[model samples]
Target: MPERKPRADALRNRESVLAAADALFARCDSPESVTMADIAAAAGVGKATLFRGFGDRTGLIHALFEMRLAPIRLAAEEGPPPLGPATPPHRRIPALLDAVLCFKIDNRHLALALEGTGGGSPYAAEHYERWHSTLQEALEHLPGPADSAFTAHALLAATRADLVEHLLGQQRMTRDQLRSDLKAYTARVLGSPASVD
Candidate 1:
């Protein structure tokens, strides 16, 4: 076992590095360009310490997912109230999309980096499954005969980071416009009329 003092210091250093990387990556739009030296400098640590904390770039990426995405997975699992007969489908549907959109916005760079590589992570899979399950449950509440599984897949595919980047960065769609269009598309795909309530 490692000494408590050294372990504690290592943990603190790791947190600092990750926090700096997350912020820088979010701002810069390209995590790959942010090197270990950049992260170490940002964290006020030596590059050696950064390397020690995470063995290599891939390890750092894995750690990022663990530190960032894990909580989202847990929250989506246990934090939100499950969709049921009592919950209105329109509200729940928009809420689900909003949660996903917020996540993409927050984790934009990390998500883009992860997608650039073909390898899939377990956390990504868990996210997709959670999204599909939550959406499927919400769709069940709606008055429709659409295949819930396919609909969930389509919804997620349409809301990917690449699409968001294109819409915001290239197409220059305003946030309000994106949200409005997403809501309309979701309602139409589910075969549900817009709610006035």
Candidate 2:
């Protein structure tokens, strides 16, 4: 059977909920503090509407995160240099990590909310698996004894939302400092000279 398109009202409600949630997450001190009720109220929808549109808080977070991450994913899969597959793996790997770091930093609250959604192993996340494999593939292409799988995990660890928040909030490290440190750290791992640019 052909699936029915979502009613216009349904689509509008979805957009409203997502926009409200995004704004709340962007400004909130803590992701956990933003509740479904808060989102519903912010969107001017009922609690039932929020629940009906999204299964739960986690579902809403996942949808919002996916929307935010789509561009980076597209760039990695098919876009131009630095992030695209056409870029050499050595450069692509660094670029991927840099993008990931910036994404988590820019969307810190949303990222943290997604990360803290459940007690399940974070490795189980679909996004985690996709990025892990992307990093692992690039790492494998480089000539080295680096355990690509472990290296991928370690590289990703540097961009964790919690770590980014800690360093930026309490450690007082500027974004440039973090980027430079990450670039230098990646260079040491890959046995390449760090580029000043």
Candidate 3:
């Protein structure tokens, strides 16, 4: 049988749950501190409703993270300049890296939670694969021979959530400084000082 589409109320409840979860993550010092019960209460839904909507805590976190990432993902997939298909390789690569870094920084708690979901290596995640392929394809367009696959992985490693948190939260590196540093480092890898942006 075909899966039934969610009713209007179910859709509203799902949105409420996600919004509540997002707010809790933003306010909490630790992601584990925010319980499913708390999210249900905040959303004015029952625990069963939460589970029905997202299956489990990890599922909920993944859904919320994806919801937040939708805009940037759309931009990278189809939007204009530096993030879209129309942009030049040299400009697009750094723009892509910068977007990943900014996303991690802005969504630190949620990203951290997603990373700790016991789902194993983050390298296995669908989002990671998509970002990696995009970066790799762009790297292939550079002037000389280079291992685009490995280069993409290396660039993404620099923007991992834990590293971003350590630099921003523990080490107290400002956002602009980190971005500039990443831009510079990426330039070195691409073998073009002019590409730093």
Q: Give the top-scoring candidate (lDDT).
A: 2
- Estimated TM-score for each candidate: 0.75, 0.96, 0.94
Each model's RMSD to truth, in Å? 3.9, 1.1, 1.6
Query: Which pairs clash (backbone N, Cα, C closer than 3 Å) in model 1?
Result: none
Candidate 2 has its poorest 10 consecutive residues by lDDT at 117-126
Best-to-worst TM-score order: 2, 3, 1
Tens-digit lDDT track for model 1 on 1-197?
96656678788998998898888778875667978788888999998887888897667766785677665556555555432334466677665776677667667777666555435532354456667787788777766846877877788776787778788779998777787788788778877765533
Ten residues in a row with the worst lDDT in model 3? 188-197
Candidate 1 yields a Cα-based lDDT of 0.71
Q: Give the winner by TM-score: 1 or 2.
A: 2
How much is 55 displaced in model 2, in angstroms? 0.6
Off by over 4 Å in 2: 118-120
Whole-model lDDT values for every prediction: 0.71, 0.91, 0.90
Instruction: Report clashes for each candidate as comma-separated counts.
Output: 0, 0, 0
Question: For residues 57-171, could you state the per-residue lDDT of candidate 3 as single tens digits?
Answer: 9999989989999999999999999799789888999999999999999999998888787577778666888899999988888874378899999999999988998999899
Candidate 2 lands at a TM-score of 0.96
- If ranked by lDDT, best first, what sequence of candidates would result? 2, 3, 1
Off by over 4 Å in 3: 1-3, 194-197
